[model samples]
Target: MSSDLWSFSLSTYAQPGVEPACLQLQSAGINVCLLLCGLWLGERGVAFNEHRLQQLRSVAEPWDAEVVRPLRALRVNWKVVAADDGELNALREQVKALELEAERHLLVRLERTALSWPQGEATDLSAWLNGVAAGAAHLDRDALHQLRVAVTGT
Candidate 1:
């Protein structure tokens, strides 16, 4: 695993909650391919990086695009909330759940993507391990274990 990537992901999780965590992960080089898919599904005006989308498309299968598009759109829309305090907390919880679901789906997609890797591209196992190491620093052992299982299908 790349220590640089591991440190990056770990730093992101050290933040408050899911959105900040997601933002941090993005900053730290988490796959924005799904985020790009979200953009294709009408998630414009959110300031996603175009180069990241191109990287995602490079590794993605044609069918995977269809699968990820709606999921990414759902993730984009799920982050919206009203102004009420009570409603805001509820929205936060819902967003957290959605983020977790998105991460799970990303894990599956990454696993599939790993299978078709080119000669020098890093393996999914290394990436998963890096994510796990990062997650372990912030999440509980149980949550870390769950993430491991999600990523590795074990």
Candidate 2:
């Protein structure tokens, strides 16, 4: 019942690795909240308003070049497939979904770091940048697990 999707990303990925266990748990309706929360957070940022998306795209340009572009290419290719190809399209959607989720998480984290800066700290941006880096590093560990689980279906 926790609203904090960040924490549950790890568990969500874990579920896929143990599919039989998860199916059993699902049947019993136990702790499905983690899965639900991950799904919710995973989808939340995929459709940001145009203005916000623009801002995010701008900020993400440098880091996103390598990661986002390939995912987008995959999504586009997936979209062009004939309607009868459901499985491939579904896989593409999942890949795109996870990429969007990661992007959203990073965007929010970057924004939070930016907002935390005081006017005077503009003179020494390195400290703020370091803090953001550390925070991202911490989040990456859990996010990686969540993403892996999402793709592999543990």
Candidate 3:
């Protein structure tokens, strides 16, 4: 797996079951970008410190709420008419690309925030997710485990 956040996210999301799992988590109002970052950190063996996580959240939350979420919503909304309207479908695909680019920017922001942290101690994937999610009840444990397994190749 690629070590960088952007590459790791792309590769992981491409894994079987991971896209649906991520969408499931996203539909439940959890931040998929943060979740992806957490997985990347865990994979890279970053220190997983609380301060680092807080920094990540602070950098990500507002942008995610204001920017990424809107693009995602717009794209998802288009699905209703995308099948019938070719023009709308094309627009929706453009929105999808914008949403992905927005996520890439978020990952870049996250990468910058965690740049100083040492990848010294390997952390358990589940523990890392739990920390980043702060025990969000909406998250699906089974899907999360599947994602973890997919990313870890275990």
Candidate 4:
């Protein structure tokens, strides 16, 4: 497994049900980038703390809110029109790629945020997931658990 958050998120997201689970979490106002960063840190044995959690959130929230989501919304919205317009469909595809790139950049930013933080503390993946999900008002517990198992085999 790659130590970088982008690679980690890419691979984890390929696992079954992870995408829908992520969207479910995101719809509840959770920052998926931060959630993935929390998982990456947990896998790397970084200790969980409120300060660093907030640090990651501070860096990620705006990017996800302002850039990634809009690109995503536009792309998703184009599904109807794209089904009929070839040019529009091509543009939508480009938007989808751009949206992915945006998320990758956000993940990189998150990784950078944690770069200065010390490691060597073991944090449970489940606990980390819960902590990240704490701010989400409508999170589905089963989906979260399923996503956990899909990624961590736990």
Candidate 5:
């Protein structure tokens, strides 16, 4: 297992079905970065609680709303138009990169927030996943299961 949240996220994302699962969850208004962080916390055996869930959300929601989403919106908006325009395509690619970087930063922030939390106190992975996913509308259970199975093999 990776030692840090960012590395864990990259490793998990590379697993089969994980990318699509994450995308599905994201499309349902779930924050993929937060989901990944919850997975990492579970993998590390960190205890889950409402306060910790809110703490992570506090760090993730704003950055995602203000930074990541805008870049992603621009990139997605340009996708079809950029298909025929090389210049716009290049800019769209840059926006994609920026969106990824923003997510990376959000992961870093989440890791920092969770760093001081004790680990190995809980092994209920579902608790962490559910806690992180709780408030989202139209939560995709299949996607969440795919993510859990892909990462934890459970």
Candidate 6:
């Protein structure tokens, strides 16, 4: 385990298949930062509950919508044009960095919010993943399972 949400996220995301799985989930409207936090909590054996899930969501939603999404939108929007225009490509790279930084900030906020929560009391990783992943109408179960397997080596 990485001992911190940001480090955990970085390492887990670097795992084989995790990036594509996360991208699939992200396209399904999941907040990747929040999902990573849930995975961190689950791996740490923190028990899952609706209240805690909501608390994390509350912390993530606004920052994601207001900060992360816009930067990502700009970066994604510039992708095609950026391939040709050196100036726009440079700007897009900056936007991509900003987007990553925004996600890192969100992870920090999530970790701070979860700092007081107890750990090592739960074993059902699916509970945490599913809870955070709830409400996505078209979620990819295979992609989610890929994340679980990649993280837990199960």
Using lDDT as the measure, the top candidate is 6
lDDT of 4 at 50: 81
Clashing pairs in 2: 13-149, 16-153, 16-154, 17-154, 18-154, 19-154
lDDT for 116 (candidate 1) = 37
Over all chains combined, what TM-score does candidate 4 have? 0.92
Q: Which should have the higher lDDT, number 1 or number 2?
A: 2
Residues 1-154 of candidate 4: C-alpha lDDT, one tens digit per residue: 5678999998888898899988888889888888888888877778887888888888887998899989989999999989999999999999999998998999999999899777767757766788888957878998788777876688
Query: Candidate 3 at 123: error in angstroms?
Result: 3.6
lDDT of 3 by residue, 1-154 (tens): 5968899888899899999988787777678889889888888887676887789899999999899989988998889889899999999999999998999999999988887778858767666787776757676777778778888877
For each of the candidates, the C-alpha root-mean-square deviation to the true structure, in angstroms, is: 13.3, 15.4, 1.5, 1.4, 0.7, 0.6
Query: Candidate 4, 151: how far from true, in Å?
Result: 3.1
What is the per-residue lDDT of model 2 for residues 29-136, given as tens digits with 9 covering 90 to 100?
A: 322223332243333322222343334335555545666557766787778782469898789879889776755565444354233222331222222212222322
lDDT of 4: 0.85
Whole-model Cα lDDT of every candidate shown, in order: 0.40, 0.43, 0.84, 0.85, 0.92, 0.94
- lDDT string for model 6 (1-154, tens) is 9999999999999999999999999999999999999999999999999999999999999999999999999999999999999999999989999999999999999999999999999987899889988898699999999989978999
Q: Which of candidates 2 and 4 is the stronger one according to TM-score?
A: 4
Q: Report the poorest 10 consecutive residues by lDDT, candidate 1.
A: 39-48
Question: How do these models rank on lDDT, best leading?
Answer: 6, 5, 4, 3, 2, 1
TM-score of every prediction relative to native:
0.32, 0.36, 0.91, 0.92, 0.98, 0.98
Task: List where candidate 3 sits over 4 angstroms from the true fold.
Answer: none
Segments of candidate 1 deviating more than 4 angstroms = 2-83, 116-154
* Model 6 TM-score, all chains together: 0.98
Which pairs of residues collide in model 3?
none
- The residue pairs in collision within model 4 are none
For candidate 1, lDDT tens digit of each residue in 1-154?
A: 2122223233333433534444444445344434323222211122223443344446554434555445555646545543445666576667667655655465445335433333333323333334323422243434433333433345
| Model with the higher lDDT, candidate 3 or 6 | 6
